[model samples]
Target: MRVVTGIGAVAATVAATACLTFAHPAVAQDVKPDRAIKYRQSVLRAMDYNMDILEAMVKGETPPNKEVAAQSALFVEQLSHMPWSGFGPGTDQGAPTKARPEIWKDPEKFKSLQNDLMAATAKLAASAKSGDVAQWKGDFSAVADACRNCHRSFRAR
Candidate 1:
């Protein structure tokens, strides 16, 4: 328990030091476009924050905790289903965003990436439970690659 907690704290500290990404809640039906943007950012940022913990472990910057890793992966798996709602019509131009117009234009491609990410995270969540660092690391890479692939096509620099 302490180990899991300690890794989380250390992950937080490391995240604070690095150029970490930004967080937001669900948008109501009557929510403004900017609100949707905020909501999207929040979910992605939350994913990034949790991924940071797993990233640190994967990079060996901190010791890996299977429990902590599993927890983060599970959160990511759940989060993978979010943010798409925030990408509804008119959300392309609201607030500061890294999302690209391609996301709206080539939505099928974007949706495919979302599906890929969700699958990768699901696999990650399952693999993390076995506490096999090697398998965990490989699964982590698949998840990270899914993220990078999506960002390359759907998100701006």
Candidate 2:
């Protein structure tokens, strides 16, 4: 009876795991436009918070720390990839989003801005690793300008 019970427990666990594994992709596919907009907004907010910290360090409001700079750069790099996928159809109008319809309308320009941001963030990450405050400032400014350029064309005021 004990052996039978153990076998039943193992079987139950396996079934549950299989159910979750198959269910996940289906659930992700069904994510609504509003959810996508909210997700991208959350990602941007996180990036903004990190950027503010880096900016403070740059402006001498806070003492410069290489570890913080490096971590902030890495955070920006990761967050940059989170928003583009959220710019799907129906996301342009349904939710409380600053994103303009031009994101979907002008695909080429949007792609260019995305590429610019990626490159700028990559440079920022590399500069952070070097622990040079001057280099970090320049790289951070580049990232900021990239963001502004995208916002000017893709985001509503």
Candidate 3:
């Protein structure tokens, strides 16, 4: 009887796991416009937080820490890739996103801005790894400029 009970429990557990696994893909595919906007906003917020920390160190508001700088740069680089795909069709207008409709209308220009951001973040990451405060500062400024450029063009006032 114990053996039978154990087998039944295992079967139940396996069935429950399979149900969740199958349900997840369907749910993920049905991502709403608002959810996509929120996801991009979350990614941007995380990048902003990391940039604030790095900016404080660069500006002497905080003590310099190579590890923090390197980690922040790497984090920013990863985050830069998260928002673009979220700028899909329904996300441009329906959601609370500041993203301009031009992002979808002017695909080439938007793509250029995305490329610029990726390049700037990549440079910042490399500079951080160098452990040179001045290089990090310069690269951080470039990254900030790239962000501002995109915001000026794509974000609402």
Candidate 4:
């Protein structure tokens, strides 16, 4: 009886795994638009929080900590590469998105802005790692500018 019960449990587990394997595509090619909005929104919010940390240090609103700034900058750099995937087709209308339709229409310009953000965030991370407060502060400013530029073009006010 024990062996029979164990085999039945194994079969159930295998069946569940097989169901999921058949139901979910390997690449997730057709994510729902609302889910895409949620995905990007979460990433953007985290990026903003980290930027706020760096901004506080730069503005003298909080004591500067090299380690904290370095970590925050690195997170910003990683996050820069993430939100673009959330802007794919059919994502403009779902959920409460600030994304402009121009993103879908003007892919080239949108891509350029994404690249600018990535570059600025990369520089900010490097400057923070170098432990130069002044240089990192400047780099942080550049990153902020990139963000604002993209928002102006592709995000609704």
Candidate 5:
């Protein structure tokens, strides 16, 4: 009788798991859009500060002042938290995202661009700590390139 009861419990658990797995997609769809939008908004704000840091770095005096280096480091740290939003089911797709519908259509291209940005940002942050003006300049340019590359493909006017 104990063996039979154990088997019955195991079967019930499996059945419950199967039901939840099948129901998850519909439940996920019920997720509020505002939650996604809020995440994107936070990323945008972080990117804004990052861009400002890059601008300051570019315009700052040669040899790079501590203030400038510190700003760049801050930018890199902020960017580390970015690119949180991309084209995905139920994600924002219009004006603010210009994330071309083609992003959904050609996922590989979008993902590549996103990866490129992440790599460049990671290198930029590392270079910022090097205190080598030349390295910083090169990494800075790479970061800008990544920004332009993604914007051209994903952002609409």
Candidate 6:
């Protein structure tokens, strides 16, 4: 009986120690800029394709198609994560970041840009659904302009 009790106590102690080791507060400091850079580059790639899609539609060099518009929408949605992820603690301030600190400082302005991006992209997607070449071109240009405008102010040159 004493041997069985000793075995049970040992098992309990091992389990408790294991749980404590695993449960220690994980230090999840901010994610490094390199990790976010990949995401940003992907967003930019999507934007580049979207721009090509718009230009092609506008020139009537290619068919005005829903796929182009859908792609634009997808990229715009994807872009939401880049700015915040790439800007802060994990990023080396001296590194080549196109992001300006004003984005974090001026929350209202930053949020406005985000809102405009979403709205413009949505409009482009809607126009694409209808396969309207003219509307697609207009919305595409507008969205691109918005992107440029934000980059001008918020992104580091």
lDDT of 1 by residue, 78-157 (tens): 99889888998788886998888888789899899999999999998999988888998898899899999998888889
lDDT of 4 by residue, 34-106 (tens): 9989999999999999999999999899999999999999999999988888888888987998898999999
Best by TM-score: 4
Misplaced by over 4 Å in model 2 are 1-29
The candidate that wins on lDDT is 4
**Candidates 1 and 6 compared by lDDT, better number:** 1
lDDT of 2 at 18: 94
Q: Evaluate residue 19 in candidate 1 and report its C-alpha lDDT on the 0 to 100 scale.
A: 31
Q: What TM-score does each of the candidates earn? A: 0.79, 0.81, 0.79, 0.82, 0.67, 0.64
**Candidate 1 stretches greater than 4 Å from native:** 1-29
- Model 2 scores a TM of 0.81
Which residue pairs show backbone clashes in model 4?
none
Please give the ranking of all candidate structures by TM-score, highest first, separated by commas: 4, 2, 3, 1, 5, 6
lDDT of 1 at 25: 34
Tell me the whole-model lDDT of each prediction, alpha carbons only: 0.86, 0.87, 0.87, 0.91, 0.66, 0.67
- The sequence of per-residue lDDT tens digits that candidate 3 reaches over residues 14-115 is 998998988954554468878878888999999999999999998899998999999999999999987776676667755676788878888898889989
- Candidate 6 lDDT over 1-157, as tens digits, reads 3554687989989998987876632222344566655555566776667677667767888866677666665566456434444444544454456667787687688778877877877787777667776776787788888888788888777
Clash number by candidate, in order: 2, 0, 0, 0, 0, 1
lDDT string, candidate 2, 7-99, tens digits: 798998999899988895555446798898888899999999999999999889999999999999999988987777777666786678788
Clashing pairs for model 1 are 23-42, 24-42
